[model samples]
Target: MGRSFKIALAQIQPALGDLERNLSLHEKLCEEAIAEGADLLVFPELSLTGYFLKDLVPSVALTPESPALTPLKELSRRIAMTIGFIEEAPGHFFHNAALFLEGGEVRHLHRKVYLPTYGIFDEQRYLAEGDRVRAFETSFGRMAILLCEDMWHPSAAYIAAVDGAEFFLVPSASPGRGTPQKGIFANAKAWELINRAYAQLFTVYIIYANRIGYEDGACFWGGSEVIGPSGECLAKAEYLHDSLLLAVIDSSEIRRARTMNPMLRDEKLDLTLRELQKIQERRS
Candidate 1:
């Protein structure tokens, strides 16, 4: 027996650029999750404004004090909540940010570091890149957030692990690709592998909430999932449909996994740092 809590992942479709409607949807989902006895609720990336925001990014960008998030902040007093949105920083800069709200306040904010610009993705054209990745303390424990493309880079997960994150929350709007003949969307499989690998490597619970439905011509596959510290899928939502996936995470598993596989304990941080410095110097 260990400290356990249930989390709900809202795998829903957001109307493109419909901020008011999206807020209402989030409110409804939060109420439903609360009724279901969820300790936390997670929404997909750009959930407030939808993905594929090109020039419209500025129109829906929100600051920490934005009135648009008032209701969500209020909801967080009862249960922890996280949602992704376009964050408006100083000087008109915008970022794909995941906001963690708990105890009626904004607890932590993670801006997307790697903005995919290849193929169907073109985030770099509209958003600024986040410079750092770190974990923060929460009521549940130390946690970290990685938005969409950030999870693709191993260094991002590594940074969070080094920062003592016990849980990883990833919000994504990844579009579906590849045929069924290839076995579940190739993109979805990649995400699953990434999530499972990180959970095993860092001995942390991984919660991935992805959006569903079509935006323009691109369809997002909504296979939101919860992976345990042992790299096992605890629960998964339906593909191509809006769903509320729930799972319970046992905090004790993290300790057990870490003890069983002493990778973290045996890591040579100083050597890795020195090597990285040498690489940087060589590049410079």
Candidate 2:
């Protein structure tokens, strides 16, 4: 029998700069997911601190070893979890980071590599960008976590795929934009397309957890979803509401998709690296 993993997306609105309240919300959701027999639970980007923090970033920043995370870390012993927060690294530098906790410990950490500075986003001004994109081992399989704008850069997904990632957990705090038609927001539709494209192209599972509610005048649309390796939507949350979206993922689908498509199998990493090196030399 193949491995079947149950994932729960906690699509909840976080209280701005209120770590205690957000932690309570996460704990509640974790309990709910556990009751539902979920193997993993994922929260949205900056889940512990609502988006559009501006100057409030410092007030809510926390270290990985902060005692505030003890509750979630303990709960992780029962179920794996992906949580987002503002990480206060050494020297007071803050980063938009995600923590993958399992077995009562933080197994992996991913910092947001691409910080959007355009339009309503000013993340770069308050948070430092990460330097790497990595895939880490999990009980279900190797997985990669990308926070918000990191998923917009195709290279990040490609690197994770090359590093043997079978699952991609994207935690986003996307603000709703464009017109609403057919009851679907245009931004939501665009995000769905991006997720499906990456899943199909890499033959991997994509679990996107986006937050909802108003923050600094920006309305976040909750359209969190899970896409299978074959580009199928397994589960999706409702728009503009808090929802716990769950999906059971079949591990064998990745193998079947690769067997049929063979895109990742035939990729030429050496050629791409050499070409990129040449481009870098030209720019220098």
Candidate 3:
């Protein structure tokens, strides 16, 4: 019987470039989640500003000291929260970022490292990429955040796991594609496989909160989910709808999973480093 906490995933549809409306929705959802007895509430990527934010990035960019965040910060005094937005750094550079708030302050921030620029996505043209991936301390436990495409790269989660993160939060704005007859959406199966693999391999709890509804022509598939350390789906929200998904995670499960699997225990860091050096040298 180790630490256990209830987490809420708010799968929402955000208004494009409407900061005030999005902020209000976040406040409402935060209160709802708190009423549901959630220890933490997680929202989707670019939650404050809808996806397809090309020229709008500059207009919606928020500074760390922006007064607009005061209400959410106040809400954190009672329940922890994580939300995404466009961050305006020095020299006019912008980053897609997630903010973790607890005790009326921002405890940690993870900028989206991998920005998808292929097909319908054009993030590279409007945003700067984050350079680091690491976990930080929280009221719940050691936790880490990875936004959308960051979870697509195995290295991101690997780094978080190596950095001692026991809980992983992924906020996404993935569009629904392919035949719905196959599954919830075409990308749904892919996400399920990716998340379950990460959980099983690293023995970490995973919370995936994806946005729903359409932005311009793109449709975001809302299938927010929580996966256990052993790759079990604890809870999943319905597809193509605004939902509040909840799950209770026990820290002891990580211990049990690691003990049973021992993948992390038996990892060969030296070998991996050596191979990575070889690959870099070969590339050069």
Error of 3 at 87 (Å): 0.2
With a 3 Å backbone cut-off (N, CA, C), the pairs that clash in candidate 2 are none
lDDT of 2 by residue, 1-284 (tens): 34998999999999999999999999999999999999999999999999888899999999999999999999999999999999999999899999999999999989899999997789989989899999999999999998878888999999999999999999999998877877677777889999999999999999999999998678999999999998999998999999999999999999999999899999999999999999999999
lDDT of each: 0.92, 0.94, 0.92
Q: Which regions of candidate 1 deviate over 4 angstroms?
A: none
TM-scores across all candidates?
A: 0.98, 0.98, 0.98
lDDT tens readout by residue for model 1, 1-284 = 35889999999999899999999999999999999999999999999999998889999999988988999999999989999999998988999998999999999988899999989889999999998898998888889998888898988998888888989999999898886676688878988998999899888899999999998989999999999988999999989999999998888888899889878788788998999999999999
Q: What's the TM for model 1?
A: 0.98
